[model samples]
Target: MTNRSRPRILLIGTGDTKADELLFMQRCIGEAGGVIVMMDISVLGDPPYKAAHDKHAVAAAADKTIEAVIASGDENSSMTLMALGASRLTRRLCDDGEIDGMITIGGTMGTDLALDVALGLPLGFPKLIVSTIAFSHLIPPERIAADLMMILWAGGLYGLNGTCKAVLSQACGAIVGASRSAIRPRPQRPIVALTSLGKSCLSYMVELKPQLEARGYEVVVFHTTGMGGRAMESIAAQGGFAAVLDLSLQEVANQLMGSVVNSGADRLMNAGRHGIPQIVAPGAIDMVDFPAWLPVPAELADRPFHAHNRLLASATSGPEDRRRIARAIAAKLAEATAPIAFVLPTGGIQQWDQEGEPLHDPEGLRAFVAEMRAAIRAPVELHVINDHINERGFVEKVLAIFDRWVADAVVPAGKVAVERI
Candidate 1:
């Protein structure tokens, strides 16, 4: 292990502990050659130290300089203490070696403090929490994304026995082993953005996955939820995407009609501003999604509502409403300098919008498409395909349009060389 890089470990212990207990843990860590960069004992209500003589040897603890940064004498002050400690540890990890893993042991407050520090790290970093409250369901799953291990102390910190020592030692060894192993890097692929609803657009994604991959593109699908739409737009603004296949434009209607998945006013504008090529489709544009009838609000209660599921209540868009949505979409589309194409699936936009379905309204659909075509000043091609939005034929048409646009935008090799020095 002398030639190999050691994984940096952060051990956080809370509450007053016997000196012997601290010495035992330190000896085990030192024997493993794991560099203990930061040890936070702020929960013990004791002053931070430089180095202390344990039973095995002298172990270096966190310096007392951190106390000045955590001068706020409140229970919530633990958060600040943990942040400072984690920052120091991460810095040390970045210095000579990579952070293979991080481990912390504490009570309820300590768990909260340690989890916050873990969340600040990137997605792939390893984190382990040994907590008295580890078994509790109160823990938020979002706080633990990467490879996180949680060990529940059955009888709390005071009940530590031989079993506890073995558990902690095993955890240390596991983290060290993980650090030495090589993680295969994913191939960098051009990102292709797609908007989808689990119900309506699942089939489209299944059919288009191979097609996009064949062209060396990584398709990133965004559920047309309220926050999901905003996330996709943010990525587009960051220039993280090669092209956008906006299959589900229902969130625009949701915004106007006060549905749950409303993407605000600036849904599709970011891609346009970034000058990214886009292929837009009116999937699920025929309806607006909401919760139950009780939460539908008094203003929209009189509208014709249908229960899509037990939780989802939707209303079919009328001709007037469709026209408004179309004009709004066209207005946003007109701002794009990049090549844009709007494909209209004439047969149906969603599962319920097909023939003999409850929400099928071709008159309203036609009016919407007509208004959109009239309003857009840009080259918004309207393809009246006979298949539904999720159909294989519809996916093929979208891929063709995307291929044509991509080809036209490519700079010739000879022209590229002439422009360069």
Candidate 2:
């Protein structure tokens, strides 16, 4: 049996003295069997003190050195630092454990540079920073990604002082331990992609989870935000999902008139190319979400706005918007080779679209149903039922459709025969 290879770490340091520090750090790193593949030093602004102290001799030494040197200066220079560091980090992560963890020791500017590198990595990757401003909340959260640990440093220089040694030791251990720990790689399960906005399809998820699990399918829910829809489509492109249950498609309305959750022009077309089984419903086709106080664009300012919460409001779509949305949805569905089913609820598409609700728009609903029926060319099975979006009857209908699909997918073996002997 072949032994597994140890992880390689890229140790990045700033200024000239880091070369000396690297020797010491390497000793500790070697104890854990870490292979330091690359050592890079930053030369920003002033030259190293050793060269300055040596005067004329320093200039000749700098020219003779063959080590890779990255220069840093103004804003653009700082950006270059981030870009180079991020490139190295990305290569290491991809080659190693896909970035199990990353640690950086720096000051304010260093923190800024390191944080930018962290942000370029994926969301769940571990990030650690040793900085003077560790306690400041002003640091942007986006810079840290998800798993971040920050340490405060009293002095800038690396010394043999008790505190400095202890801190360095801990940081090394933390990075190694985190990298060694079990990482939950993205699952390979047959993903069932479902779309929902917080408002309409919360109950749908609650009801759908058990039904999906009972049939041995993994449910992946995507909120109908701009990024959420894009992420689901990206995952589908990466062959993540076995099927898609697009329950709430408010993003279609948004895409039509340039609203917030507008998933680009491709939208559902990507899933079609992959030939994944898809079932779609116009769950929240009646509205477009936006911030409460932002002036609605001149074209849509007149549309009815309902305050869903203190900060969020949605503009109720008119008949025309719904028709446009339905057409777009149908166009995407037309491209699918896999089985496609669409369900329509006669009572309401969402709680706000029901009778007596502030956003009730019957004309919009009617136009949506009419346009979908007219545009779909792929023999879409449409079931119009008189039930609310979240009613028990509606959930049963959705589950039954999925169950039928699962049953049809099975190939049964059978034959009893008495052969002559």
Candidate 3:
């Protein structure tokens, strides 16, 4: 392929310090059938060779001069400024369809800018970061782009080495391949955003997915772990969904109760903020998840617990905690500008919360339901069902509201007509 037709990868790094490494990556990318569009984020000296977008151009993008950026007080502040400039320029490049994908090489400072750049890019645009701290806890879930790729910069802290070359080559090749192959989340049909855990915990998606598909809507299910909810909220913030079925709120509980295993504070508020039609439930809201490798907190020592896996575990919260969560959920739904519904399954929320299960607690469930009943007010319709959330009745309740909304033209109708086969 010609250079213009090849996948053009935006390779970002401090060219002054990483010229050798960046040049090697550019060569590798060329061999892998991709073209490199180099962006120099260095605030210090210049690269030996010229870059397409130099540090001066990066600073200019932020409406500041390179001198002003260098004069910024500390390294963190300077890098942050450069990150802002680079991110703005990169966004413009993507918007203008000048670049197909991006890859950045960095230690802590470069990685920090890399995270910002990744978050700034549109989802599914083939962003990758070769960082010394890939997968490190130093990076928070909210800062991560839903589709960003990362690889550990093995033996790459200093100059180039054999191990570093291997990592860099693979990262370059991966970004090139991804740019050529990534399937973006296009609205092929009227999209329905659904949130739930695995079928074992919240089985609504199992029935809901096929049922929604049959209605000629495309169903997108999000696992409500920390990152999953973040992805959903990110998409919702972009006004990506025709209707949102946000049935899982364990991440909300996790955030409220001081567990790191949570989405950001704005978990249940994105769709509402964007005025997207939403149907919400308290799926898995009674469970507070934490790292299974850690000891159970002293406060939750006596609560019923379920070991989800070696990496994740959850404990059923007390009545008071459930009441707090109910209030929070109510407050979030109250802000919806478009149509919204909250379904309260009085019997139970998740499978494990049923009788004879590990997390069964009727008292806690009652407290949550009672609090929800009190907290939910008009304009935000509350449908209290006697069946568990996983039951067919609960699904019917949701579908009834959805069908009405579609009929009333509140939610967009499915793009495809139902085949009468």
TM-score of 1: 0.56
What is each predicted model's overall lDDT from 0 to 1? 0.65, 0.62, 0.91
Model 1: lowest-lDDT 10 consecutive positions: 52-61
Candidate 1 lDDT, 152-217, residue by residue in tens = 754446645787777666666655555445362242766788888775433687777667766767
Q: What is the TM-score of each candidate against the true structure?
A: 0.56, 0.60, 0.94
As for lDDT, the candidate ahead, 2 or 3, is: 3
| lDDT tens digits, residue span 1-421, model 3 | 1133489999999989999999999999999889889999999899988899999999999889999998988899899999999999999999898999999999999999999898888877889999999988788777888788999999998899999999999999998898877776666789889999878999989889998988889998999989899899888877888999999998999999988888888899889899899999999999999889999988789999999999999999999999999999999888878888999999999999999999999999999999999999889999999999999999999999999999999998887775597
Model 1, position 332: C-alpha lDDT score: 85
Candidate 2 per-residue lDDT, tens place, 32-89, comes to 6555433233443332332211212222223422222233346455445444545454
How many steric clashes does model 1 contain? 0
- Cα lDDT of model 1 overall? 0.65
Total residue pair clashes for candidate 2? 0
Question: Model 1 segments beyond 4 Å from truth?
Answer: 1-186, 199-202, 293-295, 302-304, 382-387, 409-421
Candidate 2 pairs with clashing backbones: none
Better of 1 and 3 by lDDT: 3
Instruction: Estimate the lDDT of model 2.
Output: 0.62
